[model samples]
Target: MIGLNLRLHWIYVPYLSSGRSIRLQINTVIMNPNLDDVDRKILRELQTDGRASFRDISSRIGVSTPTVSARVQAMTDMGLIKGYSTLLDADMLGQVSVILTINAKPSHLEDVYERLMEDEMVRQIFILSDSRLLCMLSFYNQVKYKMFIETISKIPEILSMDASMILKAPKENQRAALTDEAGLLIRCYYCGHMIHDEGVKIKMDGKYHYLCCPVCSKLYKEKYEKLRKSA
Candidate 1:
């Protein structure tokens, strides 16, 4: 099958007393596996409400409940649907949130990243194009926040660190918008290569697997079987 570009538009309402909402729209380009219209509809419904029931989606999308369930399961197996989560408000929980921009020496970038990952206060991390690390951290109070910063200051690999307190978040959206041009991209299960076309699909151990070529497919199957036997 060929690739497709999908566009998705949805409304996002944050769970706050501010009585605010935002309309999010974006065009998503999905590479490597083919997704039909039915699949797109299912995704749109789920992205709008992760807790939406199968029957609810079926009624809205004009599909059967079984079809919706099966399609969701298939997409989940393909690693397209990671999982669902509930968004929580840090401000409501009386937590101090801070954004930390850390610049580490090129030679010790990975080491510094791992060190930060071990800290319980770190919530999220992103690597910027300039090799700087952007970290989102949360602490219960100012005391804990100060202690955490003091500890991080001693890390020799860290060249510079800047911290900014988040006073307020007017809008927060964890869900991504899908457009007609958006498609889900899947990688080869064995080689980790992006699949541009309909690659070989294999099902083993009740799980779906995709491979870029026949050679990798054979090798992956053999390895899987050997590991299963050893287990």
Candidate 2:
């Protein structure tokens, strides 16, 4: 959480249901997170439900939607909310999803993302400040876990990677705080798409509504303009 003063390559990308893929340049986006209690609360609520309407967040936070919107915008401008993701029923999806902790060569962290990102089955991955790594990956449940582990072990940069099956609670639960980048990436400024960083990703400006990007912001302005004139 601290000392990310180091520059990183962060990439914004799209999540596709049709099996289409988009390659992204992963930059280490330093999160200079500054939060008040309300900002934290807004994040908590949003984390629970990415699609929660702005009206709902405003009501819960006891502020007007515009005020909630303003604060969310400010937080996003500051890079607090990294993304939002849909919590999928991995088992239902018929692919085996498990948590893998990799202790690849510390210097090889970038290489890990570079090589690992090439695999479509690799869902979500993270790099630890302590030079360790953790990833959530899903493939055929029928495939032996060790076989997959062995395949990765072949990577010259991988020091050691261990993976285990994770059990999902029947109901949703909050993960203990490690860091808070995941909550902000839910809003997209383009095409009104809302993504939960379930696997792929996008970017944000979210108090209650999602801001896709600068272009989407302009599109929103024009969209409302057309609406106003038509009315």
Candidate 3:
């Protein structure tokens, strides 16, 4: 059986100002990053076997070697494909995974975020409701974990912190999945023109739509309001 540690703490602190605490929201859109099926297949193959050669990928995906290479390069340039790395076993390294939930002063949200990002032990960070943060950290043992906690406590912005130990991790890092559906052709919101490349996409009224260019995308909101006004 996989062991997991879960902890929760409820604590209240005094508010310093009348202004409400700022809350940060992360973009969790699950779209295909505006790429076609061929690109998606290339990404899926590379993610499955990072060391796979271009020739091997081409053989499996039924594309030319040069085409595969070009697609990979384009994805990298677009920042969709970050640099690859090897996944190591934490048990073999005698390490334990811990999740940390922190409450920071409203004034120090950005500072705390930047500092946590720079910490090598932190694997991931999440912004939560109102100056709150969650971080995943790994350490060799409890002694190291305590030391790291004490170090982080020194940060003036940190108001409170809670920790949960991960006894068993069934799933850790997984890449995005590829779908068989074809990508939608982008069209301008204003002029209804087709976008060949580098078009803008925006979400309005809980739906996402494409605008052929930056200018149209920027002005689309006004167009939406006018349409509403007319109706």
Clash count list over all predictions: 15, 23, 1
Model 1 C-alpha lDDT per residue in residues 84-171, reported as the tens digit of each score: 9897889889999999999988888889899999988899998876668999999999999999999988999898999999999887
Error of 2 at 133 (Å): 2.6
Better of 1 and 2 by TM-score: 1
User: Clashing residue pairs, candidate 3?
Assistant: 3-168
TM-score of 3: 0.64
Q: By descending lDDT, how would the candidates be arranged?
A: 1, 3, 2
TM-score leaderboard ranking: 1, 3, 2
Q: Which lDDT values do the candidates have, in the order given?
A: 0.80, 0.61, 0.73
Q: Which candidate is the best by TM-score?
A: 1
Output the number of the lDDT-best candidate: 1
Residue 45's lDDT in candidate 1: 89
Error of 2 at 34 (Å): 4.0
Q: After superposing candidate 1, which stretches have Cα over 4 Å from the reference?
A: 1-32, 229-231
How well is each residue in 1-231 modelled by candidate 3, as lDDT tens digits?
Answer: 001122232323333485454332222212223566678888889888999999999999899999899878756643457789999998789899999999999988999999999988998898999889999899988898899999989999999999999898888766354566634344465788866635555567765565555456545766797988899
**What TM-score goes with each of the models?**
0.79, 0.53, 0.64
Locate the minimum summed-lDDT window of 10 residues in model 1. 1-10
1 or 3, which is superior by lDDT?
1
